[model samples]
Target: MKAQPIHTIRLILIPFTLEITKTLMAGDTSILQQLGLQLTPYWPDQEAIDTFPKIIHNLEKVPEPNGFESYMVVHRHSMTVIGDAGFKGLPNTEGEVDLGYAIITQAQKNGYGLEVAQGLVNWAFQQTNVKAVTARCLLANVASARVLERLGMQQVSSDAELIRWKLPKPVTQATIK
Candidate 1:
């Protein structure tokens, strides 16, 4: 697959491509590790992710049905795996879409998170007939808020469990190059 270019007002974030598998079988662990990200499906090492079983279960289905997807975001110059960004489902009632992403710790300071995140959002809005994209972030995660804001999503509600933000419609469009 070719690289994709994402544009914001002052910066441009590039994407590596979309990759999905039951496990981190073929990807280079060291390279992904240097990017400050865990190739493991679950955030923290554990027995296993509850969702892992489902992911594996759905592997056989081509063009994954719904609420399932993944992608890698690569930095333009370095060509490094800066982060993993993608949506989980096609879309749900009320047009709510779930999104998840994380940048390697080493690549955190740069705007790659925002750039790639916006790219994901733009892609999602374009691919599906959805009205809005939603994400849940920890209230303390300022970095997450910053990234969401860059993608044109605003905080709409907050609860004890999560900080919710919604992207009504992506005004910025990016295409894979």
Candidate 2:
């Protein structure tokens, strides 16, 4: 079965089904029409294309999408695929799921990156197995850093080239009882 989409105010995040990924890898535009989404000129760019093998490998493990892989970021108003975002894989033993996202050049600076990242983090936190959501951005990527900060992720560590951020699940009254 296909995973249900995660809807935001201005975007709908559709998980990449095996068929969808395979079609996308093959450079077919029919998947867009089949999903009722319009295609942007820059979507499924080189990076997205390069990641297909891994996405496909991960999706193939389950009988269906289980909400732990890539999702195409669709603009709600235009119904166009602007980019992709999703968890790297299932939560680790430490219960952390890595997050990654990118908005196409045409869609950047419109706050879609933050909206989709926030949506993905929110969804991951709701999962019982996820204790925290983690992400890494290049040192020079100020935009991504700002988005992570806005999402309430604290800087946990950094190296010469990359900075890591993590957001832990908030404690609730129910959890303390």
Candidate 3:
């Protein structure tokens, strides 16, 4: 079955299919138009291109629901592809998953990062066996650190080069008599 699209406050997270990834890797915008998504000039960045091979490999090994791959982040208002974000892979034996996100340069500083991160974290926690989400960023990426912090993630570890953050699943209360 095809993966379902996830909706956030201002964006829609659509899982990337092999065809779509290939088209994106080729720097084709026709696919976006065919998909009825608006075109944005900031996507298909070098990082996204560099990561496609890994993404394809992962997808071939473990398909959706089992594989954590990149999702195209589309702006709800403009229906444009703004960037990409997702987990590195399925939750581990410890119920922990790694998260990654990037908003195109044009879309940066617009709070889309926070919204996407929060939405992904919430979705992960809802999945079976997922207890926490973790993320790591370069020490110099203050913007990314802020996004993680806004998601209520705490700094679990850090070194001179990178900072690791994690957010545990939220508690749900049961009604009592």
**lDDT on C-alpha atoms for all candidate structures:** 0.58, 0.90, 0.83
Ranking by lDDT: 2, 3, 1
Clash counts per candidate, in order, are 6, 0, 0
Q: List the residue pairs that clash in candidate 3.
A: none
In terms of lDDT, the best-performing candidate is 2
How does each model score on TM-score? Answer: 0.64, 0.95, 0.91
Per residue, candidate 3 scores C-alpha lDDT tens digits across 58-162 of 677664544266788899999988888888877889899999998889889999999888888878876767888999999999999998988899999999999
By how many angstroms RMSD does model 2 differ from the true structure? 1.4
> How would you encode candidate 2's per-residue C-alpha lDDT over 1-177 as one tens digit per residue?
356799999999999998999999999978898889886778888878988898999898888898989999999999988888998888999999999998888789999999999999888877888889999999999999999999999999999999999999888775455
| Clash pairs, model 1 backbone | 16-74, 36-104, 36-105, 67-88, 67-89, 68-88
45 Cα displacement, candidate 2 (Å): 1.6
lDDT of 3 at 63: 49
Weakest lDDT window of 10 consecutive positions for candidate 3: 168-177
Q: What is the lDDT of residue 89 in candidate 3?
A: 76
Per-residue lDDT over 1-177 for candidate 1, one digit per residue giving the tens place of the 0 to 100 score: 132445545334433222333333443355446545445433322212334443344344434333235455555454444555556655677766778877767667877677667666766676546778889899888888888887778889998767898988644555322
